[model samples]
Target: MWNLPYVFPMKRVMLMDIKVLIVEDDPMVAEINKKFTEAVKGFLVVGQARNGMEAMAQIPVKQPDLVILDIYMPQCDGMEVLQEIRKQDRPVDIIMITAADDTVTVSKALRQGVVAYITKPFKFERYKAVLEGYRHFKQTIMQKENLGQEEIDGLLPVRMTREERDMPKNIQAQTLQRISQYLLEQAQSFSAEEVAAGVGMSRVTSRRYLEYMAEQGLAERELYYIAVGRPIHRFRLVRQPEK
Candidate 1:
C-alpha cells in the first residue's frame, strides 16, 4: 500500500521589528496597548510615555518606527506633539487613539498627518485590522516599482469581497468570487436569509459560506435585536488575507 506524504507549510519571517511608542496618559490603557502590539508577530513596543512632553523626550532617544498616541493628556496633547515632530522633520508614522467622538478633533488629526484613527472601546480584532492595513500601506510605499494611484489605493484597507474573505474548505472559486462581489456592493450587514435571496442560494448554503468567513476572521458577525422576535445575526466583510 502506498502512503501519502505530509507537507508542512513554512512560517513567514518578519523582516524587522516594527518599533512602536505608546503615548497615553492612562497607565492601564498604555499597558493594554503595549500587550496588543507585542502579541502581533512583527511589532514591538519600544517605549511608553504618559504625556506629549515625555513623548518628545523619548522619540529622539528611542527612535520608534510608529507612534500610537492619545489626543488628550496633561502637559501636551497629541496634535501639538505631531506639530513638533513635523517641525523636527521626524519620519515616524502616527496613529491617533482617542476616546472622543468629536468630528472636529478627528478632522484635525487627519489633516495633521495621522495615518489612521481608532476610537476607544474597540475589540482586538478591529485593532488588528487597522494595524494590518497600515502595515500593508507602508509596504506598498516602500516598493520601488512604478505604480498607479488605483494600485496605491488598493493597498489601503477597505471592505473585503465575500469571496476574497473566508470560505468553506471546499468551495468553487467562481461561485465564491460572484458571492463576494455581491456582498461588497451591499451597504449594510446582511442576514443569511437576505444573502440567500440575493445570491440565489439556499439559506443553509448562504449561512455556511458566511460562518466559514467569520471563522477565518475575514468577516464579522453582529447580533440585531428586534422587539417582536428572536435576535437576528448579520454578517459583514471586514478583512481579508494580506496581499
Candidate 2:
C-alpha cells in the first residue's frame, strides 16, 4: 500500500451573500428576473415588488444589497421609486431594466445613481454576464484597502471610447451622435434607410455609421424580410457587457 503525503490548505474567507430586491410591474418578467438572480451563486432574492409604492414599502424592510428596477410602472414610475430610495438615504446599488432605450432616460437614470442599465429582450447569457460583472466589481471594492479615482471608475460599466465617440474618416461627429442617440432611444431595430429618414442623414452616410457600430460591437445586424426582393438589414445596439 502506498501512502500519499498530507498537505495543509489555506482557509478561504467566504463573503456574505448579496441580498437583492426586484421592482417590476410585469409578473412574468419579474419572475424570470428573480429566477436569474437566484441562479447566480452569491445572490439571494430578498423580496419582489410590482410597483414603486410596493418597492418603497419592502425595500426598507428587506434592506437589500441591490435593486433591479423597471422604469415603467402603473402606480409609480421607477424615477419616483429611485427618488424615494434616495430620500431615505439608502445606499443600495441599483440596476435599471427598461424597454425604453432613449438617451435622455438613460442619462437620467445614471444621474440618479443607477449602477447599470439593461434594455429589455436581452439574452439570458447577457443577463448572466452583467450579473457576473457586478459580482466581480463588488468583490473588488470589498477587498480593496485604498482605491484611487481611476480604480473607483474602473468598477463602472465600460462606456463608448473616445475614438468610438468620434466619427470615422469622412463622417461628422454631430451626425453620428444624433443617429446613435436615436437608436439608443428606440425599442426596435431600424434600417439604415429608416434611420437616415429619421435623423435627416443620407442613407449612404447612415449605413457607414451603422456598419462602424457593428464593427465596434456596439451594434448588431439582422435581416428583415418584407415581401423582399432582397432582405433588408437592420441594426440594434448590443447591450451586453464588453468582454
Candidate 3:
C-alpha cells in the first residue's frame, strides 16, 4: 500500500482565541469595552490601558493579537501609538474606537493601517460586526498563504454589517445624546463640570461623556495653563450634527 502521508491531505491548523488589548482613557469605558469584547466569540480581553503611554508599554508584555485604541488620550495619542506599533513590524491588528470622524484623522488612521473604525456613542451591533468581520479575516488570512480575489474582497470591509450593537447599560444613550446636543448648543468652551451643571447631572458622569465626545471628534478639549492646580480641560463642540 502507498504511504498514508502521500495519500491523505494534511489538516490546516486554525487560529485559537484572539487576545485583545483595550486602550482607552476612561476606566469605565475600558471596562465596558471589555464586556463587549467578551460577548463576541473567539476573543479575550487580555489587558487594558487608560492612555496611550500605558498601551505602548503593555503591548510587548501582553502581546495582544489586536488593539482597540482610542484617538484622544493623555501622554501619547493613538496615531502616534499606531505608528510605533507598525515600526516593530508585528502582526498585531488595530481597531480604532474614537470620536474623531474627521477626514484627516480617518485618513491618517487608514494610512497607518487600522482594521476598523468605530465612532463614539456607537451601538453594540456595530461593534460586534466589526469584531466579527475582523475575526473571520484574521483567521482566514493566517490559514491560507494565497487567497482568491473574492476572499480578499470579502475581508476588505472591516465593518459590513448594518445592524446596531448594544452599548453598556450604565452609559445611557439618551443622556449622551442630550449632552452632545447641549454641547453643540453651547456658545463657548465649557468644562465637564460646567456641562454637568447645565444639564443637571453629576460632574463625573458628564466628564465621561465629554471625554468620549472629545475622542470622537464631535468636540475638542483644550488644556488651560493653571498656576496652582492641574491643567483644566475645557471641551467645545467641534462640529454640528446633521439636521
Taken over the whole model, the C-alpha lDDT of each candidate is: 0.76, 0.78, 0.79
Error of 2 at 112 (Å): 0.9
Best by lDDT: 3
Per-residue lDDT for 1-243 in model 2, tens only? 113133222243456899999999999999999998888879999999999999999987999999999999999999889888887789898989999899999988888888888999887787787887687667656765877543454465565555644545775567656777888788877889888988887899899989876654456676665552556778876533232
The regions of model 1 sitting more than 4 angstroms off are: 1-14, 155-243
Candidate 1 TM-score, true structure as reference: 0.61
Kindly provide the TM-score of model 3 when superposed on the true structure, using C-alpha atoms: 0.59
lDDT of 1 by residue, 114-227 (tens): 888999988888788777767655554564376654444354446456455444467655655555666777876777888888889988888877876555444556676655
Sort by TM-score, best first: what order? 1, 2, 3
Quick one: best TM-score, which candidate? 1
- TM-score per prediction, in order, is 0.61, 0.61, 0.59
How do the residues 109-177 of candidate 3 rate in per-residue lDDT, one tens digit apiece?
A: 998889888999888889998887787667667867987543454456542231232334666667877
Error at 55, model 3, angstroms:
0.8
What does candidate 3 score in Cα RMSD to the true structure?
Answer: 23.0
